[model samples]
Target: MINQIYRLVSPGRFEITYRDMSLNGNKLVVRPKYLSVCAADQRYYQGRREASILQKKLPMALIHEGIGEVVFDPTNEFEIGQAVVMVPNTPTESDEVVEENYLPSSNFRSSGYDGFTQDYVFLNRDRVVPLFTELNNHTASFLELVSVSIHAIRRFKEKTHKRKETLGIWGDGNLGYITALLLRKMYPESTIVVFGKNDYKLDYFTFVDKKVLINDIPQDLNIDHAFECVGGRGSESAVDQIINCINPMGSVSLLGVSEEPIEVNTRLVLEKGLTLFGSSRSGTVDFQDAVNFLQQNKEVIDYLSQLVTNVIDVYSIKDIDSAFEEDLVSSWGKTVMEWKI
Candidate 1:
């Protein structure tokens, strides 16, 4: 089948191209319903990545976080017109002990391969997770990001931390908000504190135990564990603060994406006995868990609804450009694309 795909041909440039989508056996064809723009996607769209990396990764589709409707299922697994979240992490090789996302051979969408920016998407039966019909497209579009936070928390639980009473999350962006919110739901007994630079963004985190400005953090304040949700140049300072404020033997989950290497305070990390772990794109199980979590937690769903600040309907290539431009300047919340094409 020939499908129309929107690809990033160059920095700040997109081209709609035609491609042959081979409908192999045992695969499902899905039509993208809603797509969410991620920071990683923005990095590619704006050519913020390193020149070498951009040269290699350009001419690829630019969306991995999306929900789609089943258009065709040859095996009769998913019902026609069912809403499902497409899993972008495609593993070419697997190990008994290693997860699919951790495998070196895994091919992630929107990174080196074409993403969901096509008229039709073909996936293995296992790559899609069904969603409730009532879920809003804005919320469903960002399920991939929520699953990443859930995946990080799952990894955090495996650590042997001396304490998990107080959790400090640095960065007031969407990732920070989602991670803090997920932590609050997963461990109600634990106190969650958010640290960020923007007052307006921090204001939305009212459910947390406390919100502190990164500049105004008290010298004596400390946490049992920390999550560095700030990436890029800001990650260096975020990591520093996490190391300085986290208690000894604390676990820190790193969820940020940085194009360049940043320095870490290894001296402080060793002195504090901090265990830092990094989490990237999630897998099929994480997506399922995230969907189930949203289904069971109505209150969380309500709070998350506020994160949808901008929703643009994409009917043409110009609309796609407008969405990216709007997201680039938006101060807070997620900008979701309602895929009409």
Candidate 2:
């Protein structure tokens, strides 16, 4: 089988090799159906700190947010024509012992093994998630990211959150828009507000009923809950906006992963008695819930696909380099690769 392996990190790009590998053991062969690129892939492609660490310590397959069809399944969990979503994290055989709230062992799939970017690749049976027919391969490819956004929204609702509370989002990126859409379903009556700088990018979020420029975000606005979706440097401003705007005892969820350490208004959080929490990937429970949500709310998801602006063929993987360059400069919604088998 041929696979795209991320070998090393360099100044301009990630060194990748398309090479052949043996398919032995209980490894199930999956044919790539569709793959979506997240901000994490961009950071890794750019040789960022986290991606560099993973590249050094382990062999990671490039794309994590993807869906595939089982081409060769010796395992009983998968059938020849089944479509499934993959959870990227799982425990490796060499993994050091660690407790986890999501999985029984550690989180380790995409990091330890080859991912779903090639024509066909081997994967463990346990990592595959069977997607329903309601979600086509293209839309199902985003199940992982949708699970992340759903988990973050659920985390925000654990407190004594009011139904009419005004929720504010700090970023207008893909994850930010998804979080907003999920919250709309969870709290139909609540007023949701989105904040970002780019008007062109913001135009893609027409699905979000309320939006505002970052500058227009009122310093004293009555914010009930805030989600920080923009990671990397300068994200502190978003956190500060949440701290300044949130009401006393309101909650803030840090869904963004910052590359640099950001300073938060600790005084404001402490003085106002704000509740803060950090959200990562979805747990197994959350994953099941997200699948159910998508199944139950198919109409909503069809509408949500409008947020997807670009879909390129995987045969044109060469175009990915240019797409990444353009995406770095300016991108509105999701960019995906359609696989033809």
The prediction achieving the highest TM-score against the true structure is: 1
Residue runs of model 2 more than 4 Å from their true location after superposition: 1-27, 50-59, 92-113, 159-164, 207-209, 316-323
Lowest summed lDDT over 10 consecutive residues: which window, candidate 1? 156-165
- In candidate 2, residue 30 scores what lDDT? 76
> Per-prediction RMSD in angstroms?
1.1, 3.7
Pairs with steric clashes in candidate 1: none
lDDT of 1 by residue, 57-105 (tens): 8899999999999999998888999999999999987799999999989
Model 2 clashes, total count: 3
Task: List where candidate 1 sits over 4 angstroms from the true fold.
Answer: none
lDDT of 2 by residue, 47-116 (tens): 6656557556444556778888788876566789788777676544432332233444554434444555
**lDDT (Cα atoms) of all candidates against the true structure:** 0.91, 0.71
Best model per lDDT: 1
